[model samples]
Target: MMGTSGGSEEIIILSDDEDDKDTSCLIVEVEAVKKTVGVLPVSPQDEDLVVTFSRRPDVLPHARYDCPIHPFMPTDCERTAPMANNELICDQCFCYICDKLASLCGMWCCSGACHCNSHNKSDFWNDVRNTALLGELQRFNLTLSEVDHHLRNADTMLQSFRDELSALFSSIPLDQAMLPDYNINQQDLSSRYGPVLECVTLFLNKADKKNSRAAAIMHLGAAEEFMRHFQVLGFMGSSSAATTSETIIMLLHRVISSVQRRIVMGDITPLFMQKLQTFYQNRICFPADMRPLKNRFKCFIFGRNLSPVFCSLTIRPWQDVLLVSVLKGQNVSGFRKDKGKKDILFETISVVLLRTELLQLQSRYRELCRYLRVVLTDNTTLYQHLQDLIPFFKCKLGEFGSALESLFPPASPPASRFTPPIFLLYLRIFETATAPRLTVSQPEQLCFSGASWEPIKDAVPLKRSELVKFALKAQRCSLPVGSDPQCWASLLKVVCSPHGSPTALPVPSQQFLHESRDAVIDLLNQQGYNIQISRCFLKTYPDQALLLLVTGALGVRILQGSFSPALPVLHAYKDNLWAFQWLCEGMTSSEDRLKSFLKEITQESSNT
Candidate 1:
């Protein structure tokens, strides 16, 4: 210990302190630790019971039907019965005493023995695998297996039809070019010019069934399955807008291929769905109105059709979901190259989704409306609907947001193709809006003063640097368990101006950059947030005015103590590639000097 000018003994401690005894006295007397635990955050993950997967409960795909399946047993009803010597009060109710009974697909049995008591065998799945549609389905199965020989078989079969059409066309005499038909032609045509030129009509106009007939049939069938299965049935088009034969062929064939694969792969579960999310991040966003068929079919085989067009519409056939992609819009090509209006790929997906499947969700719009409290802006309403159905389209918000960072290069970015709908998606996933919603301080106390987070030392709202000080005061607060995590992501990304480097302010508008930056620092100081979250906020906003966020707010305080966590924050800001880098480096390095200068009136804490 050394003597101070004020006559109190001054103790000095080093990093290699040999004794823990005088260290606390020297440090605590010289400095105080300031930390702020901001709002409680919504934990990113919560433990959910691992779905002990069994066979899915039998219900329609969208219907929520839950049934617990047990191990398979013999077909003997008597042996499986829970009660011996069947003494049910009623035959329908197979209980020995109670009238209550259960039916496993209409076969009355003990609830204890019957696994699917809710179902009736008469419900038609009761029609075992080889039931009502068995024969036709067996034939349909041939479509998948005999696929290699399909076009060849079709070519031979169509030859007869081609010949039939040829003969029919030959019979129609041309009136325009002096071939008046009937009397003279009928009698002597074959003997005269008939044998030489033939009736010619069928030969010129009709397709020779031998070549294209088979392909046409298969294409038609595949197209039908895609439209019908996706619940897009009874769809009609005019002469000006026909779903082209080539397009139908592409969609149908691709689906035929995928259907078999999905079947072979067996049932999909949530666990399987989660696995798919990993790869989904990098998928190029297709345009809203994308017809992905042509894109899909270019490299594949030109195989013959499996089903006829008419039959394709009516049949319940498995087909590829990938075929349902939207056709790229011609308008997309017109985008100004440098524009970032929307992402091209997702634009296509959104448009196609809106036109196709999203229409169905409109019915569910009423349900979503109730959830939104009916006061939702049009944007919020769209957000809710998209959130629910996004999984079905293989669109996960987390994955999409994660992907957005990669797709956009640091420089020379492409036009943002996100329409309003897609933009809504971005907002929900990336950052939640805190606009117009007042966020009070932790412990959420309301004194005679307005908000707990209101001004402490300012006459007018504090200038950029000063606001950071008041926000720092909030660090002293202690909140109740499970408070909402104080938000930073949204406030940090506000971008200051409509367009500019984020650091270039819009006349320093209310200094959101400063406020948000300080808020993040406060969060870090209180041990209120994770390292990643603190980093994300700091990374997003690095203005010099916001430097205290890392240094004065967090780094300086941590440096004087034995805390190690704040050191990493130092390394992170070292690069200064973003706006706050320079300030971050300076602040962390100048820790002691800044700490003594900033907090002259230090209060000792009772709790560690």
Candidate 2:
């Protein structure tokens, strides 16, 4: 048993036999061990110290901080020391000589520090500096090598493209002034001209046998068909058509020459010979009723007389009737001023005359009317009745009144030679006869005094002619999908100007309007607006301001993320509200305010 005393207190342990004796020896040894290794005292402040040790510092110190080898070394110390005449220093955690950390330093590593001592005179630092800078150089060299390879490839491709383009240009025919003369056969001619020759032959045979108006009309229609064919085949000018006509005339002349030769050789029968003789005999006989037909036949034989034939076919009958009834005074009662027959005759005459001949006929008829007024002065009723006919002609000719000034003597202004009088008349008729009536409802009257009122009232009227010209210009500017950027920009500038008012803008055609609307939609979509917004813009704005509004919307969309001021949030904005507000506030607002607003929105967007 073993006993320990603390402050005069003693304790003893008893064991059985030899086992107790061994236990006492073990206890004594344990007491001796406890005295050799003492326990440290612990306090509550120690827990705080442990926590502080475990926490990370806000900022980390430099690698050189508290370094044992270079304790006085600054954090920003250079590799070379200023002292000792710029001697090289090894201050890094990694040892240059050993090529390892300082903790792993050993004498056997890198053949000890004998090489480290020779740093000042050795080429080791120079080699290391070059290696450090060479990494970036290597990367730059790789990039430049790749760029040079691509440049060479691009040069080769460009040269190949140029060679291909040159070959293509060389293969294309450049001479457009002279087209090849194709050798067309009789079948090809018939297919191209469409029975015009047959009509001409039938008319010739009928005229030789009998004096008939049907034959004359048929020949006139055939001539018209021939002219139409010439136009379709790109014989645009009168000279071109006349030149082409020579070939046809030569073909007909050959047939006549062949017939004459056959007759000389006695190739025809007796009955055919008698008919041919009678046909020739009739050519010399000039009956009064057959004179117009004879004149038309003579004109047809001579290819150069084609224009006079077109005119004479329509004018000759009327000229004969007027000469016989009015000038010769043979049938004065038939053309009596009071009779409705004269009116019907005049109407028929007007309908048959071509646009080019209308002015000439009008001047001639006006002169005749003046002559009748003087000749029938004794018969006041007949004279007054004849005077009444002048108003009908005036009313019928009113549609071409604008052109009449240039055609007649007094004022001959330079007019558009391309525009036809019939087209102009059609435009006038559409504007007058088919124009939409302005019927104001009660709700419309109340909205009349709204913000759009003053601008609509002050808007200038655009002429139909101007609208047509603008549409043609826009068509030229348009591309397959949209329009050319520069061309569209110029057109927008013109329409957005003060002189070009939106109120009176005319639609040239439904197709043109649709295409223009589609172009505007495409432009808006390209500018990042959604399809609904693009359609809304089109529905909200007038046609004249379509391009202008689109351009403005794009500007606003860039700055404010919406097409207009009224539509601040594109997704949330109502289309109905956009239409109503845009017509009022958006259109009536001054340009300066809009510009300033755009500028502010741009600044705000940039700041955010």
TM-score of each: 0.19, 0.18
Model 2 segments more than 4 A misplaced: 1-355, 360-494, 500-519, 522-544, 548-608
Q: How big is the positional error of residue 101 in model 1, measured in Å on the Cα after superposition?
A: 57
The lDDT values for all models are: 0.31, 0.33
Q: Candidate 2: lDDT of 148?
A: 34
Give one digit per residue, the lDDT tens place, for model 1 in 1-608. Answer: 44478655566654355665764444425644599889876564645545676894453211001112232222322224433322222223322112134332233343553322222222332332222222222222222223334444543433444454345434445431133223343334344333322222222222223233233333223233233322221111211112222343344444333322232232423232232222122222222233342233222222334332111111111122211221222232322222545322222212222332322333332222122221112233343444333221211212332233322334322112222232323233233211111221111111113322222121222233332322233232212101111111122232222222433432322354456655655555564221222445435444543544534444444344433222323333333334344334445566675454234313122121
Looking at model 2, report the run of 10 residues with the lowest lDDT sum.
435-444
lDDT by residue for model 2 over 179-237, one digit each (tens)? 34454344543454434444445444543332221222222223333333434344323
Error of 2 at 506 (Å): 22
lDDT of 2 at 186: 41
For residue 461, what is the lDDT in candidate 2?
Answer: 32
Q: Kindly report the root-mean-square deviation of model 1 from the true structure over all alpha carbons.
A: 34.7
TM-score of 1: 0.19
lDDT of 1: 0.31
Question: How many residue pairs clash (N, CA or C atoms closer than 3 angstroms) in each of the candidate models, in the order given?
Answer: 44, 0
Candidate 1 regions off by >4 Å? Answer: 1-160, 174-401, 411-415, 429-608
Best by lDDT: 2
